[model samples]
Target: MASASRDEFHLIVPNESQSAEVKLGSDVTIPCHLSPEISAVDMEIRWFKETDCACLYKKKEVIEGRSYQGRTGLSTEELNKGNVSLNLREFKESDMGVYLCQVISEDRTEEIIIEVEERKDSDGQPVNQSSKIQGRQVHLILHESNRTWGENQRMKMEESALMTEFEVNYVKVLHQTIFKVFKNQGKKLEQTELQLKESKTDLERVLQQLETITEKFGLLENKKDLDMKEPQMQQIEKQLLQITKYTEEKQNQLEEKDTQLENMSKQISEKEKLLESTIKEMETSKQQLEALRQEQMRQQELLEKKEQLRISELNEKSKYLEETKSLLEEREGKIKSLEKEKDRLNEELQDKDKRLKDINAKLIQTVREVEKKQNQLQGKHTQLENMHKMLSEKMRRPENKELEASQPDEQETKSKLEK
Candidate 1:
């Protein structure tokens, strides 16, 4: 036989129904400890009002409500010693409750209730109001002469009115607090009533069990009845023996079925392993195919870009070729016109050369004629000089003067007439 084992976790509260009282505005500590006095450093401790389940402390942290904020604490030192007690500061009448100190360890949970009561003052009046008034310290002072005494009196009256207003508000707060306490009490009472009902039912069941036990003991005391039931007891024993055999047979069948199931499970695991390997292979192949597709798409895009570039280059070349053809045609037409102009100029140059040659021959002929005229004028000037010299020689002869004189008159007359 296999014995079940579990962690031994337990809590010990000195008094399960511990009750403590403190005056209003006073601090109080509710105690709880571990059963084995073991470290509860890792345990969760919850301090909540059992009535309303309002949590006040939890797991090294305080879940402070509106009235509990800055007023609840758990000492770390005590927690290490397994003391999951809660220290409540500034108690109020509304804080009165059956608070639960729950210690939750690894495998076990334990809880205890701590009844905290609100202690009253010496006059049997609630101490909450006394503390509130003392803490407020409401004071009014006046410094005025008799002339302003009337005004001071009015101010004093106003101060009294303000105090009364504050008092009324405080009364309202007290009433509300009382109402909340009653409401919590009513809830707690309802829970207690339910618990009582459950207890009554359990007690009735226990009483019925006691009655059945007593009737069985009375039947066992009669020897005559036991003797009369001997055959029936034997028959019951035989039937029990048959049931035991049947149960043994069923157990054997179940064992066989369990063995078969184990074998089938092993086979299923092997199939699952093979399937996983196949799936991994398929995933790798899919990844490779995806990569190939991506590469193909990239190549297709490159080809498209190259084709577009080539088309653009071809268009540019065609445009350049067309321009070059047009320029060649224009150059050919200019060459033909230049060739014709050159032929016409060559003919004009030949005709001008012939005209200059004719002018040169005419000038040479005119120069020869001028030279002949100059020679004829020189001969005429020399003949005139010879005739003057002959006349002078004849005038110098004296012997022949008479004959020359008579001729001289005629010569002189002739010479004078000639001169």
Candidate 2:
């Protein structure tokens, strides 16, 4: 019996590692498998709410309880074949607890667990809240919650007063620093001016000495003055030669400028003609573009007119289609009526054919009866003719006998009288 009970019962439930969460008011399926060695025939199965220790089902029937009524079911057909899965419908938040499936055999029991979860909103809040985070106004509340103590009204007032005091002290320090820097810069500027003036005086004395040497060389024409101060005169002559070369370069540049001016005048005249031609081409292009734009506008108007005509035609076609549909519906009704009449006539024809076949059968029976009576009458007629013929022959035989007797008697009488 223990072995028989072991073969008839098995446990089906989620293991500790196989548990999953399901939202409330949704459908859930708990997969359970029976041992292959066990047959579910004649075995009692039960689903128990493990948290409250309440029975959910027993022997394929739902147990009546507030916690388990109308909530639990099993695939009974599959259960007999060792599939021990439960189907739970319309789950509730109160169902968020462990569940156990208990199978009772002849001598043993088995159990399993299922976990349920309550439903949550997209923002992870409970669904029953009036001010859900999904609402637009809830963002303002969240923003207000994010403010720090340092950013509050009292802290701002304290920080402003402190900042004003610090600014006054900062301005006083800045003014002192600026005044010291300006006094030092003024002393440095005076020394720089004295140095520049002294350098300028020294440069003017040197320039005067150079001018005297240049004038003396310009007057001298003797070889004795060039020999006694030949090096000095050569230096002065080099300086004058540089000045002359620079002056000649400036004169050449002026002549090149005059030639460039003449060339520019000729180029300007050609460009003016080209500009006039370009202006004419631009005017022609403008006229062509204007004509093209007018043509485009005319074509657009024509297109609009064509579209309007097409729309009117489509409306007419729609009206015609509606009329045709109504006509088709009427024709269909007429055809249906005609078909019904045809069916009635066909039924009547079938009835007439049946009657004709019955009448023909009756006529054939009556003709057969008449033929039997005619055969009996023919036999009676033959018998009556034979009896009449026999009677006539008998009557004639007696007459003939009487005549012979009378003739014989008369012959004898006459013979006697004559004798």
Candidate 3:
């Protein structure tokens, strides 16, 4: 059965409701809770990356492991308070994956996943070079990269070739189409003008006929002076009266036709106005279409520029990668050489250490000998002092006896001489 320590703690991460997506370089906090009261203060905290399933932090220190050595950071203060959130600085696209925070307690172990995302630059550009969009403002900077500039130049040449071909084809087709349409419109306008002129001529002829009838009526009225018999005169007068009536009726009919002609003329004028307006509208539409085409051409040019920039950037990156690989290989070789030198130095150090130990032992032995010699010298000095004292005492005693004898002798001689 699993130990209770393995089931006492739980790890929690932010859900979708809490955050939609977390961007790179942004601080993130993960929450963990211990159930049944955590008592094992010695429990170890570990953070593992899911991409490689490698430990990033362990035992309150960053692991000297492969890729996470310099890239991972964590807050010790937060960890003490059961906050084992890890902060990755300068977040990379590779960091955009799941991470696991593991806590090993006496009774339980818990883990949680954290997702990292690529950060965007101030201009809303992705940090990953592959995901960056080419901007007009960045063109000059991108062109500075030799590879990108070269690719851009090549692409420009290719696009110029293609555009030239397309322009030739498009212009030829457009010219033909426009010429045909203009010719047809011109023919239609000419036909309408001819019809209008014919209508006007017919109207003029009708007016002339009405005028002639009026002249005839005037002649009949004037002829009233030349009379014959009453019946004959009455018949001529009736005929003249009929002729006048017919001329009046004809005049009314001509007036109606003139009105009709005027209406037709007005309609034609209105149609001409409409046609002019339509032609203006068509001109406007053509202008707009031309503008749109020009804009599209500009956009294509921009796209080509972007592609060139991308190709150049890729080449530069490849070169940089190559250089980095070479540097890394050199560093690896240096590290191996240093390792060997370190081993050699360690051996030399061990030999020096042994020599030093021997030297220290000899020094200690010499010190003991000097101490013994000092003690012997102290004992000999004490003995010599005692012997000299004895000798002094003996010499003083003999001298005193000799002086007393001399004095006694001198005194006896003086006594004898006095007697």
Judging by lDDT against the true structure, name the best candidate.
1
TM-score of each: 0.27, 0.27, 0.27
Off by over 4 Å in 1: 1-284, 366-419
Clashing pairs in 3: 5-107, 5-108, 6-107, 6-108, 148-312
Q: lDDT of all the models against the reference? A: 0.57, 0.56, 0.55
Pairs of residues clashing in candidate 2 = none
Candidate 3 residue-wise lDDT, 259-308, digit = tens: 76567567656766775686568558756866776787789889999999
| lDDT measured at residue 45 in model 3 versus the true structure, 0 to 100 | 59
Candidate 2 lDDT by residue in tens digits, 1-419: 12333545445433423433434466666666676444564566555444232333344543433345566666666755666666767754454455555566667766555544334579987445443222212111000011222223233333333333333344455556555655654565565455545545545555676778657765366666558776765765675565456545545654555565556555655655665576567557646865776787789889999999999999999999999999999999999999999999999999999999999999999889888878876776675566457555655777877577556655764574455
lDDT of 2 at 283: 54
Error of 3 at 2 (Å): 88
* Candidate 3: worst-modelled 10 consecutive residues by lDDT: 136-145
